[model samples]
Target: MIIKKIIIRADASIQVGTGHVMRCLALAQAWQDKGGEVIFILANKSTALENRLLSEGIKVVYLLAETGSYEDANQTVDFAQKFNAQWIVVDGYHFRAKYQKAIKDFGIRLLVFDDYGHAEHYYADLVLNQNIVVNNKDLYRNRETYTQLLLGTQYALLRREFWQWQNWQREINPITRKLLVTFGGSDPDNVTLKVIQALDWLNKDDLETIVVIGGTNPHHEVLQKEVSNSSLAISLQRNVSNMPELMAWADLAIAAGGSTNWELAFMGLPSLVITVADNQKAIATELDTQGIVIHIGWYQQITLEKIGMVVQEFIYDQSKREEMSQKGKKLVNGYGARHVTSKMANMLS
Candidate 1:
């Protein structure tokens, strides 16, 4: 086992979304599989997210201080010491150099989950950037000599539910009909409703769509009403646990370009990615440049009518769909959490 105890510091909310927490959950699950214990130190109260963690047999602790603030790190350290945690992992943009150094000041080993090299400097024993396109790795060149970077999709931490489907083969049909639309755990801008409206414009009598909403989506009532009234065949799924199964069921996905992108890739589901966050634009563009998915530009900059036109064109592009599916499956092999956990064990040794 890898020191037996680990603590993760992350938060989920409308502003921050749930990617950090979900990815950390993947790490926590991997640790659990190795007979290790996991605890979460969060700055916000997301009841559904918290309940999901508890049901997985992991413990969660909410911090009273502001997220990523100096005091936030202080509270996290107190819990790390209380549990005698072997290592502390921090994820999210709010966790910066000060937060990392504070955790390390206690002599506890630290691992940091990074995206786009947001931190100016790092003191963590290990730093992981799981995105396929990370243009800012040079930013970490000035860090401590002991700091190690684990980059690329090879370290993509997928949830435990996806582990079983790692080896499952996808058989692409000649014609695409089924669709999956998910805009991450929190669609604060209600982009999902727009996507649904676009799907309605497709007006393909044979088309089917599943629109997934996160637990924190404040516009659920509005979205549900739209779904109930839509002429297109559509269903709304909330806080679903069978994401991998859903991915397998769909021929293609119209999704928000976030952590879920990796899941779609692992399942060999070709996607049209619409980015909601500012930083997500670069990642989406890179995925497009790499031929992994078709980037539909920033959410606000894209119109629903334009989105419908893109979907209509993509539906009949059989050759392109197959190419993207194969390329995606090759990029993410679904052993990321396994590789990361093994590295942690090696670090302790």
Candidate 2:
């Protein structure tokens, strides 16, 4: 059977961050590639994010109601009925059991993208947890018996652009000099500034820095000012299109522990990870344990001296950097999106 129409329910903003919407975009891209139509339902929208979806030829339906509210769910159901969507994909921690059950009660097939199983109960036809360290059975013990679990990094939803770099090789330099810093889309706590400040303290004349920020970041002006005034050679990249190229070019990175961790792993870029949110703790810890990245403690606990020290260590240690590069590549093969799309297509058929 052909999966003709798909409705994706996700949101992007300063508070919620853009990971949910971006990952859903990856799935939507795969669906569209297979001749399927996709529509997005969002409550809190950013103009730049909406423009991105429009550029990809996908339709967007704005939801004025609060996220995960009864009214929001009703609006989602209304749109699902209007489009006759074959499947409804719900992402974000805001979406809970009630929201999932409401869509399922409307007689539509539901696929939920989850992190840490924040839902009190699960009613979707499929529940997907794309984290590397989650125990599916333990996290979703209360889920409906009919619900199928798609767990772990095997189903990691990456964007279409990264797919093209699957066979691309990275030239790991013996002495790491170039660095990339990205602290997710929102960075509400302004961790990026702290990182830049740390780099400034390092004061390495030979270091080259590339800083990437999202459109919704409230600290953009502050960051630009910081970069301009700092002695370090920092290049500020906002809402960049060539992330894969930047990842390829960087010898090392300082990043927040989020979905971008998977992208960095796929590219074999060794990184120093800082946990900016509670949900990120497990990911950072696991990556650190696996020797894929140096998981520095939480953002609040991490000081500039600590960041500078770690940077210096990574820069001078060629063997450890090479080890991290190899381990990260082994963890993520960069084909998770295609694998997930194939699974969804098979399920629809």
Candidate 3:
């Protein structure tokens, strides 16, 4: 059965970050490939991102209301109705229980992309928590009987670009020399600068670094200047399209504990994770405990010395890096988006 159209309610900015929008794009791409139309209702605006979505032939509807507010939900429902959307997918931490109820009140089928079960309650037709550490069913125990739970890494939503690299093999070097640093789509906290500053402590001529900054990043100028003046061999990449290639080329990664962690893991790249936000804590901790990554605590608490020490340790310990790489690859097989889309198709049918 053709699923018709799906309405996605998600936003992106320096403040809210871009994970929600990107992941939604992944699901939208899967649905689009299956002969379904996708429409996005966004509360905030990012011209570059909007253009990117438009480039993919997806419709973008700008909503002039507070994110997750009653008005926002109303606007979303209006758009969904206009498009004759078969399902509404909502992502972003700001979209809470009230927002879910508001959409459900319209008698619309809803899919909630959640993290850590932040809502006071769950009322959506489906709830997807794609984090590895989300094992406790009690988190969603308050949900409605009809609310289906799609938990764990199996449902991790990765974009179509990543799918091309699934069969790609990663070569682990005996010593770590190349590093990829990505602090999510919007490093509002400018943790990328701190990570770059910390690289100064390494003082290794052979060390090569690649730093990726999102288009919405407020500190791009500062970061570019820092990279220019730095003694380290560093390349600053903005809004990169070839992430999988970069991940494959790097021996290790210094990344924010966000959605990119899953991508890194899928690429079998051992990484040092820094929690830039509270939402990222669980991901960092779980990956650390599972030996898939080295957690460096919160971004605010981490110093240049701490970052240097971890990098040095990883560089010297080839065996440890190899182990982490294998563990990470074993954790995420990179077929999550396809799996999720298939389930969504079945649900719609």
Which candidate wins on lDDT?
1
Off by over 4 Å in 3: 1-3
Each candidate structure's TM-score, on Cα atoms with residue i matched to residue i, is 0.98, 0.97, 0.97
What C-alpha lDDT does candidate 1 achieve relative to the native structure? 0.90
- Per-residue CA lDDT of candidate 2, range 225-331, in tens? 99999887898999887888999999999999989998999899999999988999988998999899999889999899999999998898988988898888878
lDDT of 2 at 123: 96
- CA shift of 264, model 2, Å: 0.3
What C-alpha lDDT, on a 0 to 100 scale, does residue 184 get in candidate 1?
90
Expressed as tens digits, the lDDT of each residue in 155-273 for candidate 1 is 99999999999789988887888999999999899999999988887687688899998999999999999999998889999999999999999998999987999999999999999
After TM-score superposition, the amount by which residue 81's alpha carbon in candidate 2 deviates from its true location, in angstroms, is 1.0
Candidate numbers, best lDDT first, in rank order: 1, 3, 2
TM-score of 3: 0.97
lDDT of every model, 2 decimals? 0.90, 0.88, 0.89
Which residues of candidate 2, in runs, are more than 4 Å off?
A: 1-3
